[model samples]
Target: MFDVIIIGAGVSGVSCALILGSAKERPYALNKKIGIITHQKASSLQTAVFNNAYGIPAGKLGSELLEESLAHLSSTYPQVEQIEKEKVISIEDDKTFYKIITNKNVFESKIVVVAIGAGNPMTIEGLEDFVVPHQKVPAIKNRIQLKNNDHLVKDGLYVAGVLAGHRSQLSIAAGSGAAVATDILSLWNDGNHTMVHDAINK
Candidate 1:
């Protein structure tokens, strides 16, 4: 069983998993097994341009970011499993954790982050049979509305990137990933975690 299962290989999903994978001192990094399930490659990363992706100058290829990020993840978290070319059918709550059933395999995890791009929504038959119909869908604003300061769409279910409404932009999507990761860390730490700030103390 994994500690976390991210259902996308896009920037948001990768960013979230990267943070946890690199946090060596944190429980998630040290003890958790993280999984990323995706069909083919991240479509956004393949075709996206960095126009609005803050800090990144225009004209840079999105594929570059994808390659660099994947390289870093592999090096930093060698154990991170990437399940490619598989489409997720549904996510079921198993009381203690979540069961992510895909076309080719099944995964169990304590937490789930749905970061799939908004442009392509998965068509799962009878998804209602497993998870509650809580996640929002295709329409721009229909994306899941996360609870303030937390990424919990519902209990163990979390969301990032376009799934949470920030679509098409890489920077915002990555930022959303970081936000969810921070919240997940807080939850895992029994809500005892504190946010960091670089601003000078008054």
Candidate 2:
């Protein structure tokens, strides 16, 4: 079991995981199968480190921030692992731990962070026959589960990053990941075992 489990390898997930690492917290990432998971890539959302006062820089953000975050995490904790190329089927929570099931593996952790680019898939009635129904995790309030399904757990799941922003930029996603981690760490150390929110929809 992991102390924390972060989903996706995007800036949001990666950056946040790095912070936990820096704080001496060991975390795991359930990304795709790394090598087999085609096109699993990362881009820094640093807004071009140096840009004109007029606007955001259009340059490609590299590994600077991510590298720095990694350095901190590596220095603080020695056992952080990034699991790649795994498609998550669902999440189950029971206050003490979250069980994450992927196509190839299953992982257990105390905190579940959702930094996935967007919310999960949603299924509708009319398009049920025409297209495959996309399922969203259940029990999401602070987190947006793209699906209308009712089977997702309501506790121990944190929905943040691109999923929270309906139409925000990528930079927001990066910060969201870190922010979610901050909240989780805060609550974890405060002796509060709740999921950070009183209600899933409120």
- Best TM-score among the predictions, by candidate number: 1
lDDT against the true structure, per candidate, is 0.70, 0.49
Error of 1 at 188 (Å): 1.5
**For candidate 2, lDDT tens digit of each residue in 84-165?**
5676666665568867777788778876766555432421111122122222323343223333121112345565555544
lDDT tens readout by residue for model 1, 1-202 = 8888988877888888787665646653467678888563546577666766677788877778777777778897777787778988878888899888898888899989987765433444323322322244445443333332245677788878865755446777898898888787777777877343334784
Error of 2 at 173 (Å): 1.1
TM-score for each candidate, following the candidate numbering: 0.77, 0.56
Judge candidate 2 against the unseen true structure and give its global Cα lDDT, from 0 to 1. Answer: 0.49
> Which predicted model would earn the best lDDT?
1
